[model samples]
Every structure is written in structure tokens, then in C-alpha cells.
Target: MDMEIDLSNLGTVNTMFAALFSKLGVPIKTTISPTVLEEAMNGIVTVRPLPVGTSATGKVDKQCAHFFGVTISEEQAHSGIVVRVTSPAQSKFKLLYFEQEVNGGYGLALQEDSQKTGKVTSAGMYFLHFQVYRMDSTVNALAMAKDPEAAFFKRLEGLQPCEVSALKPGTHIFAVYGDNFFKPASYMIEAMCAKSYEETTERLKEIESKILAKRNDLRQFETEYRKALARFQEVTNRYTQEREAVDDMLRERDNIHCSFTTERTLVNPVGAGCSSSRYTTEHSIPESPENGSLDGRDKSGKKKWFNLNLNRSDKKA
Candidate 1:
């Protein structure tokens, strides 16, 4: 059966085609009958074009794609999405349109074939490959190679405006890739079976709101941490000053005690005889004790006493 798939309107064409193919399985010779072909041709699906100036755009790098259909960052070889379309076996899938905005004037190159190195040029001539895999396939493109099929299937890329005739019916993964050295590129992409522009726009807004909220929370935490650190420092400084003052007082007390001990030693000699030899006084010493007591006498029968006489002159040595 003859069918016309117009992709001129890059915005809405992919959506219409996706809806159409979903109802009509892959047009295989064995399964697609003449009646089904006619029905598909007559039944045209129309999708509303995204409102003017409402198209959503996003950034993609070799590492990740943000706010776009699918993203692969430089750190990763590929990015994927699990897509469930109506006619998985017979659908004619296409990536009708995409727009890219770049930063730092860096060009992006997408690998068209897994075995070959995709070329790069100063001009923004980049290509993207899509690979579709069965949903049940345990092989994860993001994971390390477990087997040859998993490895091979994971690296596979498909042409844009992808032709899905060869894909089998069921849930599948759609993976995108770029050249190994592809720089950070910002672009927007839409797929035949992907969400509508409006839906994507809304989803992006929700994601942005969540990110902003998280940022605010982090800022608040940082402010609180700084304040706490300041308080701790103040306490430490005060404690150090108080401790130093106490140390100073103890040192002064020790010095005073030392000085007092030295003065007392000079004033009263420990073993020197306290006779008129050291100190002289005008008052004469009594020859004997009045009560026959020897309270001030030393063991040698000499009196040991300090005589205080203000009128006495200094004695000769």
C-alpha cells in the first residue's frame, strides 16, 4: 500500500508518525495485510505543534543531557531511555528534527557506526546514533561488558529519523551517542514516540523547581555552619585568655614567696651565734642571770641574745 509520511513540519511530524505507527505494527510482508495498509494510509494522525516560542531546549555533554530528550556525557559512551510504543514490531520510527546550541564554539560529533570513527569538522556537522534493544535484555549499556551480545548491542547506534521496521515488538531501549571527543553541546531533540513538547516543558519546570529548592537548602546549611564555627572560635579565645591570667597569678605568687624567704633568712641567721660580735648596743649585758636561769645561754655557757641599745655605736669586727 502507498503511504505519504511528510516530515516538513519538524515540530509535530514525529508525534503524528509515532501515533500512527503505534496502531500499525511494522509493515512486514507476512503480517501487514492489504486491508491494514489501506486503513493506515487513510487514518492520518495530527499532532498539535508546540506553541510558538514555547519550544524547550536543553544542554547535553559527553557526560549527560539536561532537560533534553536523551543525553550522553563525555564520561559515558551512551545514554538511553526505555520506550514502549504501540507497533514495536512494525512501526516506522523517525527522529524528524533537532536543534543544537553550542558553547565555547566547540563542535559535536556523533558516531554513526560503531566500527568506524565519525569525522569532526569546524562546521557544526554532528551525527547521533540510536540503538533499540529489547526490554527483557539483561544487558545494560551503562554497565561493564558481561557478554559479547550485551556489549555489541549496547554500543549499537541507529540513524536519525530512525527506521524501526527491523525492531521487534515489545519494550525497548533507545540509546544515543556522540564522538569520543565531542565537546559539551546544548541541543533539543524530539522522538516519534517521545513525550509531546508541552509535556516535556512541564516536566522540565518541575525538575528546575526541585533543583532550586535543594540549592536554597544547601545555602542555609552553609550559613548555619559558618555561624557555629564563629561561636566556637570565640569561646576558644576567651578560654585561652582566662587560662593565661590564672597562670600569671600563680607565677607572681611563686616570686613573692621566694623573695619573702630570702629576706627572712637574712634577718635571722640559721647557725650564727647571736652575740655582741655581730650587733653592738650601748646597754651593758648583766654578768649573771637574776633568777639563776639559763634560758638564753648556749651549750658552751655563753649567753646567746640580741641586745637592743639605741645609743650604742657600731662595734669593730
Candidate 2:
């Protein structure tokens, strides 16, 4: 059974370094370059002195160095994505020479640093000089090792901030050389990724546009909310006015009913329009003989005659 190793969980710096070196493959003795350099993966390589006639022809080529091939895809190269090559200062890997070289040729030289008080060429300076280069195709490592100073490579431009910010979308080669005093030195190579200024500007513009669109949406939402609130207020006011009007009408109806009840309580039933008993008596029908009146004579014995025929003629008249 093949045991599966989970490289994702190896969190220690030493483990990561070892893993990166393993991924970079074994160090080449005969100049067959490795093509496994990656972003954020720090790897170490030891450089030994080359023979007298190897790559030490010009100011750029060093006697002891290793070549690495880094490829930038079209997607990575878009939006000003940059591949940065840097040596960690704390990695005990003080550089004697670090530069972006041609795939099959000697690398480009840096400007002479007049401030340093030693050998005047760029090779004598123990600092990293970053540059970008373009190759026609993938490097033939064995061919490069045989004729390491060929004329097929072109030095495109020097990279500021130690990165190839705007390199063409293709695979490129770089050289990391140690001190040229025939001494074997161990150096750590750290790769990093960054975005160029143009990319940042474009991203800021995109963010601003999105924010502006959101603000417009919010403004429109506020406008709609205001309109809805106004309509709601108008409806509430109308409902309140209608309710008050209905209450007034109900009160008026109650008052009319109370008035009718009071009128019914005050007036006599026999005289509907009269409030007094006298008026009631004048309008009432004459008492019958059974109710103590024969000829309109009361029980007090006072006799009074009411002619029935005369009352009939009076009613007719």
C-alpha cells in the first residue's frame, strides 16, 4: 500500500523549507536547471565553484550559481500580477549575486554602485539586483549547461522592488549565485507575489463603481420609503377624519332619539301634542256611565248634561 503524505498540514518553517526543496528537486551538478520554483515557497541551494571556463565570462555570469525556471501563465500575468524573487536576510544567505538571467546566455549586469569602496563592477557588490528577462521558449537545461553563454536570451528591463511586475506571459529563467571566491555557500531563495500599481488602481476603480451603485440603490430605496410613508400618512389621516365624522353622526342620531324619548315621557298619551293635564282633559273622550258619568255628572252629585246629538253635530261642523 502506498502511504499518502499530507503536505498541507506541515506547518513548521523547517518542514516547509524541506518540503519546498524537495518540490524543487535535487540540486543539479551539471547545470540541468530546475523548473519547480513557486510563489511563497522558500527553498535553499548550495553553490560550488565551477570550472575555469564555465559561465564566468562577463560581469553578470558568476563562477558559482544555480539556475531556476519560473513560469508565469497568462492568468497570472494579467492585472499586473508580479512574481517577486527575494533572499531572506535572516536566512544567512547574503547574496554575492542574484539576478534574472537569460535562459541560454549570460545574465545582464547591474549598474555599477559607485558608493561601495571595493572592486567597482556590479559583481563585487554583495547585494541582490533584480531584473526581468524573456526567452524564446522553454530552456534546454543540458544545452544551456554545455553552452551557458549563448546569445538567445534578451534582457528586457530591470525590476524595481525585486520583482518581475509586468513580464510577458511565459516561462522565465533566473540565476542565484554565491560569492565567487571558490567557497561553497548555502543560500535561501524566497519567492513572493505582489500586485503592480496599475492593478491596484483598476481594483480601486472597480470598488468605487460598486460602492456608487450601492449608494444609488440606497437612495432609490429611501425615495420609495418616503413615498410609501406619505401615502400611509394620507390614508391614516383620511381614516381618522372619516371615523370622527361617523362618531359625530352617531352622536347626532343618539341626541335625536333622546329628544324623542323625552317628548314621549313629557306629553300625555291622550293628547300627543300637549304637555299639561288640562289640555289632556279637554282633548280626552267623555267618561262613560260605568266610569261614573251618565250625563257628565260626577260622583260629587253635581249634575251637568252633555247632549250626545249636539256633540255629534259639533264634530260634523
Candidate 3:
């Protein structure tokens, strides 16, 4: 069996594979003056006037990407370097980090033509983009740009802290720009060698100790939370039982109906026949209630005087 493959469409095939494997890049549509960019390439110092890009029409370009390069010496690269950008109060700028590729495609040209064109048609041979060493992981240039103007004011108000650590021994490129339609003014750029290995080890040990302490605190908090939960459950059960007992008592009371009836009975005294100076008179007796009896009064034939008789026809002395 014979197998053959045609490589005539090699360029097309490579292009398709590149599209499938590679990430889409942000087009370099904005640029600053080559003179200012050149000055910013010097590491470990302050660059002023903020290298803002102006369009061909002389309008400030918000999309401008000011490329700043910091070349790390072989000695500095072993320890790494910390690149920090400090913007003024109430003014802000953002940084996007990129590591230059070994092929070196004339990364972000420092030419007058590129600035006047208002676009960096020249491609940069850098990758690993748009992330800072000390910035919040969630914040990036793209995310800030996507926010609405009103919603993004607070992010622009305060000082935007931008810092990055480059470990490689080469020229590391950083793109500084303004977002949310805000223009960046004067700011400072600084690059310094990272701490020594001994210092870094000490820091790691301190962090480990603090983490252990935090774990102990978390365990204590969990124990207290469990104890509180158990107490809450006990109180809830007791309250329920008490509520049921009171309800039972109320139900029993509701079942018992209480009614009152006032009936008066007329009774004549035993000495009714004797009509002397002391005459017998009629008296009234109240019927006893079903639930209770009258206050221990003598109901027998003992001479008792009562003026509650309804029959007033009988005369008394």
C-alpha cells in the first residue's frame, strides 16, 4: 500500500492550526511618541508626563498602550526585579505585563511614524500578558474597560497600585494605559531587585507560623459555634413543651362552661301561728350554685333575721 499527503496548502493549514491553538491578541491601535517611550525604557527611576498618546488629530487617545521596558541584568535576574508604577492621587493608570519572546520581533517600535499613525502596526514578540504581581487577581485591563462609565468612577478615584515581579534575565515589557475613558497624567515608574533568598525564606517561615495560629483560632471558633447551637436547641425544645402544656390547660378551661342562675325561695318562720308582739315573718333563700355552695350559713331552724323578702304583705313587729 502507498500513502501520500499533499502539502501544497501549507500556509493555509498552518494558519488554521495557529487559529485553533493560539489566543486572539489585542491589536496595538494606540501609541505614544518614540522619544518619550525611549526614555521610559530606562529601569529603576521615575518617568514623568505619563507618556500619553495623542491621535493624528491631536486628541488624547484613551486606547493608547505606552510600552515601558525594564532590562534585568544577569545578576538582577537571578534575584528577580520588582516593577512598580505609582500614579498621583485622584488620577490613575493600569499596567499590563508581557514577557518578550526569544525571537525578538522589534517589540513595540520606538519610532515617530508609529505615534503619528495613532496605531502600532508593528507586532511585539511578547506573551504572558496583562497581569500584575501585586494587583488583585480578578482585576485586569479588559475587565476595567468593560465596566460602564458611571460604575467605574470609584476604581479610577483612588491610587491604582501596580506592581510586577519579573524573574527572567531579559528586557521585560509593560504596557501602561488609561481606561474607562479617563486619561492618565504624570506618574512614576520604579524597578528594583527582589529580596535575597535568605530573607524570602524567613518571610515564608513567618507566614507558616501565622497560618498555624489562624488554624487554631478557627478550631476554637468551631467549638464555640457547636456549643451555642446545642444550647439553642435545648431552649427551643423546652419552649415548645411549655407552650403545649399551657395550650392543654387552656383547652380544659374552654371545655368547662360556667352559667349563673339567681332564684329566690320564700320561707315562713316556724312561729307563724303565734301573733304576739314578736310576729313571724317571711324570708328569702337563694338557690345554691352547681359548682359551689353558699358561705357556711345555718339553713336549719335557728332564728335568723333577713330583710330580703319579696312578699312584703306580712307584717312584722
Candidate 4:
């Protein structure tokens, strides 16, 4: 039985076989066409999850493969899907995973051009993990196997969302996972593009206002200081003038004491100048002679001579 098989239509044939074999509980081998092979080799292929027991027989693009040197098989598709990365060298992505959620948790990731928000919705206990990384650096990551909500907010404190949104080709990855042994749990994760600048501007304005207030306080302190210095100078000048006045009064008192000393010295006795006989002669007067008698005549003559001498001494005094 000869049949014409178009190589260009291999993808359709592979899909038909995959469905048929999956229902029959058997494995189907898929052939890779030239176009698909080229796309996968160039790391431009989209990798989707495959049903159990279905196999695509070809080398997958490295961008879609999670672990290096590992084969892309049906078992891997059922377990966990590898994240697609077009340019691993230049692309920025973040991963947030949570497990075993007894309590609800939250996660967020921000980049220059993209933002992600995630939350765990469960009624049971769970474990959480969140991580953020870039091509050159790991920006932030929560502690492994711990409560992701607290770690998410803690890491967020160091990041400025507005500044992150301003970077070019910025990309961020966010995820949240919850595991419940007793009951089923659900999670929601959202990724979106955004540009933020207003928050940054508001922050700058707040800082500037604080700085201005500080500057005003300094200026007020300087003005008060100048006034206080002027008051101190005025008080000092008043004290100085009062001290000078007191000094002048003391000098005048000393001069008056000296004058009294000089006057006392001039009036005090020197040598025999203050004798008793000189004092008596300068102060005493002779009695007048009585009637007319010879003795009276002699007395009268001496009295006249003494009076003449007294008149001359009075003039000399």
C-alpha cells in the first residue's frame, strides 16, 4: 500500500496521532518538520504541555528547556512545565513559588517595564517562596520554604516601583503556589506592564520640604544668636561705665584726704616757736600806774615803754 506523505503537513499528522494514541492508552511518536526544527534550534519555538504517554520525537529549543542536557519528554510535561526564555542572557524574569498553604499569602514583583502580583487562596496551611533575578544580578529573594507574604513586603521596602518602571526593556516574573494536604487550594497571579513617575516625584518633594524646614530653623537660630550677642554687649558696656564712675569718685576722695593732711602740717608747732614765754608776751598786757608818786613815775615810764614795744610787736604779728 503506497501513500503520498506531505512533509509540510507533518504537524497536523502528529497532532492526529497524539490524540488517537492518547485515547488508546499507547504512546505516539511525533516527527519534527524542517520549519519546526529550525524554529526550535533558533530558540523561537513555543513549548506547550503534552498529555501523558505522548512524545514529541525531536530536540526542543534551549529556550523552552528547563534543565540543561535533559531530554524533553512526556513525563516532564505532566510533572512541571519549563518556563520559556527567548534570550536568557539579556532577559529579566522573576519566580515566586509557594507550597502547603494553611494560611493565605501574597507576592509581588516589579521591574522597569513590567509588574506582577500574586496571591494564595486557601483555607489550609501552606509554605511559600518568592524570588527575583536579572541577567546581571539577583535583585531580591525571600527565604526558602518560609512564609512568603512577610518576605515579599520586606524585600519590597528596598525597591522603588516608580524608578523600576523607568528602566528600558524591564521585565519581572511573579508566582505564588500553595499546597494543602487535606483540602484543595487555589492561587491567582497577574503580570502587567506599567510606567510610574508620580510617586518618585512626590518622594523628592517630601525630602526637599524637610530640607527647607531645617534650613529655616538654622536661620532662625542665627537671628536669635545675633540678638543675644548684642544684648550681652550692651550689658557689658553699662557695667564698664559704672566701674569708671566709681573709680573717679575714689580718686577725688584720695585728693581731699591729701589736702587735709597738708593744712594740718602747716598749723602744727615747729622747734621752740610754740614756747610759753612767747605766747604770754604776745597775749598779756601791763596794768596802768596809780596816782602821782615817785614809784608811780618810774612805773609809768616803764609802762609807756612797754606799750610802745607791744604796739610794734602787734604790727609785726
Candidate 5:
């Protein structure tokens, strides 16, 4: 088939796609640059899930696929790159890793152009970042042993303490004995607290930001965590969009008819000749998505990462 695309002037295709999308009422985010897309494509297409065209999940289509992303540029020359990250899910966690490069120098030009046009502000190749903190049983034991106010059996009056291990996900019942104690006392305490797991093991990060003013308290920790959490959520939401792009098949993955504008709308759209329509009109396009936000974000019209302009946030992926 004469379906191969001339990725040399990939920018024109991006402009066209964006123009068409705006007319379709499906707003999307294209952080990856065209240069990245062209470089990644070269002359190859069809990566997975689908065998033809560039199918992906979109803001309008939310199902039928699990990954979708597009790269757009306005430099007339392929000089931009887009990055997307995804979290590990299902039994195929390895397939969903923390980083996936588009390879070559595609991402570099997009960042350089971002410095020039400011269209793509943030540099760094976008990659899925998972903030997973491990909770060690030793830490808990050490904390209890170190704290004078709650150490040993002084609080319990008279009892020798046993070194406790990591917090278990079930109930606990144990006995305590001391050197000069009268006898052993058996205590049964039902520990059904989800906080132990949720707060400690789930999401955690490091401390190195000038915004929180530096501290060693709950408030400080929370402040730092929330800031990073926002960014992480942004990455997750963007990566999830790939599902839509893959489902639409020929028309949705149109390399020749893709574009973005100053107003955040797509242009050109499908039918600039994708040859993908050979399937069926009611081929059931995959569900990409409608609103692309974390909370009230993509929905509430909140400012995106570009608006932040943080010196640190400016750091590339």
C-alpha cells in the first residue's frame, strides 16, 4: 500500500492534526515533539495492541487500548520530541516501566526548540515516575525503642519487650516478659489500621525543595509530598491517553493530518488519506478519554505544568 508517510516535514502534519482535532471537540495534550515522533518512526509503524496504523487512546476515546501519545511541532522541520510515562499495572508490570525513550536525537531538538519558541517549555524526556516508598519493620522497631516516652515496659509498668518486626497487615497478639517482672502478661490488641500501610508504604519522596522552607514535621513532609504528587499525577494522566490514540486506528493515528495551535485545539484531522478506513466505518474506535485531568485539573481548566515555570520543574524529564 502507498501508506508510508514522509516524516521529513513532520511539523506540517502536526499542524494539520491539531487543526482538525479542534473542530472535533476533543482537546488533547501533545508534549512530545514531532522530531521525536519522526525519529522514532523513521519508516516503521505499528508497535503493539493493533497491527495497522498508529492507533491510540485519546481524550475522547478512553477504552480499547492502554497506551497512546502523539508528537507535534511547528518549526516546519522535525525538531521536537514528546515524552510519555506510564505506571506499572496488572501482571505485565515489566511492560509498564518507569522510563521508555523514543531513541535517537528526536527528543533533543524538541527541547531546543522549546527554548526558542517556548511552545514546549519543559525540557526533559517525559517518563513515567513512580514514587514508591518501602516501610521497613526495623524502622518501626527502632522508632519505638528510641522514643523515651514509649520505650520498654515502663509505660506498661513491668514487662520485657520483644523486638517487633515490620507491621503486618493483620491482627497481632503477643506476650511480654521482663527481668525483674512478676510474671508474663498476654495482651491482645486488634490492629486494623490502614494508615500504617497507606501513609508509609504507598507514596513517598525525598526532601529538597525551597518552597517548604525546610522542616522535620508532619506539615513540612505533607507540603513537600503534595507538590511532587501533583506533578506525578500529571504524568500518569498523560500516559493513560495512549489508549485512545491506538483505538481509532487509521484515522486517529493519521501522521499527515495532525496539528496543534496556540489555542490548544487540534487541526487537519483524519481523511487527509490514511488508507486505514479499509476496516469498517463502525469499527468501534477505542475509548481515548474526554477530560484529561488529575482531579478538577483537565476538567476545571486549571493551569498546566507550563504555567508553573518552576526553576526545578523546568528540569527535563
Candidate 6:
């Protein structure tokens, strides 16, 4: 990742070095470039110097300085994702990527800050070294991260994607050298897992609501279909009863005269003007033969059962 790197002195380059070495128990000293100091005070995008002393010291308390107007922006792609690290002020600074090792080793990458100051630029390195790992792991089992010393990058043992659990799960620092000066930088990168179940529950609730609504809609549709089928069956039953009655009346009259059945010829089987309709005259449908008897109503003249009238035959004038 060729991102624009930043190394600010916080205007305490000399004392910071002493504090770092004193903490590390190493008698190491450091130097800063005049240009790097000037750019840092003026809030310009710049790098710090990495002067060296001769002490077998340990790690230093991370100096917290930001690259003026720096940010990491990205774009997801088909193969993977492409990210950019940008700078805001003009001039030159070294940006680095790094990881800490378990065997007390450090990994680093040497790169330059974007030239466009107070603006974004597209010119950065595209490195292929993906992982930084511990010395115990194989090159294939895991990868490691590198130090931000954008000067001379040390090789990483193994590195995992985004998760620092494979290596040391703590803060890692990188030092960037602007030509001659050394500015140590720190990155608060973590490679942990997901947190908080509230978000997952909220998503599940949303899905459940949709499913419930769909189920209710299906039940309502089924109910309507059932009602329509009941009405159709009632009409068919009435039609069959009326036709049978007509056939019985003809047979009864056949004993009186046999020649009339032959002359009628079934009257074309339909269109005899028998009208059918619902009886919605506010009469409740009877539940049973004993529903509206002395058990439901008193000895009053109140209607009890639901009924429909059919005009099948008129007294011929």
C-alpha cells in the first residue's frame, strides 16, 4: 500500500529522543533535519530525521504526531480493494507500513508521501508483500506486518489480513527517514474479530417483520377463497333441487296424461326464468333446528332463521 506517510516532531525532537532512549534503557541519540522541523512547525506535510546513537535499547514510547492533512480512503473492487493514503501540505515525507514480531523483531516498508500537499495525489507504491508474521510461523501459514520506517524496511516473518492476533496484538511503530533525519511513527492497527450482537439482532427483527406480513397476507387470501367457494356451492344446490322438483311434478302429471311429457321435450333444458339472489334482509342464519326455539326466543313473533325466496313458477293467469 503506497499511502502518503507523515512524521511530525510535535516540536520536541531532541527531548523526545532522550525520553525514548531513557525509557528503552539504551544510550541512543537522534538528530532532526532543519527542513523537516520547519515544515512541521508550519503545519506542512513533511518527514522527520532518524539519527542513531550506540545503545542496546528497547522500544520507545510512541510519539503521537499526525501527518498534516492525511487520510486513508478506499474503493472496493472485483479482485480486491484499492486504498489510498493522502497528504494535505506540500513537500516530501516518508510513509511506512509495519508489524511487530514476537521474537522482538520489527518489519518495515520504505515509501514516500504523496507530493500533492493539502491535496490528494495518485502516485504511490504498489507493493506485493502482503503479510507480516512471527518468526515461528511458515511463509504460507501466515504473513506479518512491517514497520513504518519509510527509509530501510525490515522483512516481515508472516502477516494475516487486518487481524493482529497472528502476531503481537499491540501497538507497532515505524520510523521514516527524510533523506537523512529519522522520524519514528506509530500505527494503531488491529486484527480482531467482530463485536456486539445488538446489530445482528436488529437485522433479524427486520427480516422477521417482512416474513410475518407475507404470512398474514396469504391467510387473508385463503379466507376470501373459502367464502367464495361456499357461496358457489349454495347456488348449485338450489339449482339441482328446483330441477328435481320439476321432474317429479312432470312424473306425477304423467299418470294423468302420458302424451304431455313427449310434447314438452324438456323445454331446451334452461332459460325458464328462475331468478336466484342472496337474502340479506337482516335475518340471522339458523345455527340448528332448536336454535331460535324456546331456547333462543320467547313466545313472540320475532323472525329466527335466514331464508331466500325463489320465483320458480307463477300461478298461470
TM-scores, each model vs. reference: 0.24, 0.23, 0.35, 0.20, 0.15, 0.19
- lDDT, candidates in the order shown: 0.32, 0.37, 0.40, 0.33, 0.28, 0.34
RMSD of each: 24.6, 25.2, 20.2, 30.5, 46.8, 28.0
Top-lDDT structure, candidate number: 3
Worst 10 residues of 1 by lDDT: 120-129
Best by TM-score: 3
Question: Could you give candidate 3's per-residue lDDT for residues 63-147 as a string of tens digits?
Answer: 3445556666677666545444444332223444543434432233211111111221111111112222121212333444575
lDDT of 5 by residue, 163-193 (tens): 2212222111111101101121111111122
Candidate 5 TM-score, true structure as reference: 0.15
Q: Indicate whether candidate 3 or candidate 6 has the larger lDDT.
A: 3
Better of 5 and 6 by TM-score: 6
CA lDDT of 184 in candidate 4?
Answer: 22
Query: On residues 181-242, what C-alpha lDDT tens digit does candidate 6 reach at each position?
Result: 23332222111111223354345447545544654565566577668879999999999999
Off by over 4 Å in 3: 1-61, 90-92, 106-166, 196-317
Instruction: Write one digit per residue (lDDT tens) for candidate 1, span 178-250.
Output: 2112243333333332222346535644764565465456656657766897999999999999999998887
What's the CA error at residue 12 for candidate 3, in Å? Answer: 40
The best-first sequence of candidates by lDDT reads 3, 2, 6, 4, 1, 5
Residue pairs that clash (backbone atoms under 3 angstroms), model 2:
none
Please identify model 1 stretches exceeding 4 Å from their true place.
1-212, 259-317
| lDDT of candidate model 2 versus the reference | 0.37
Residue 270 accuracy (lDDT) in model 3: 37
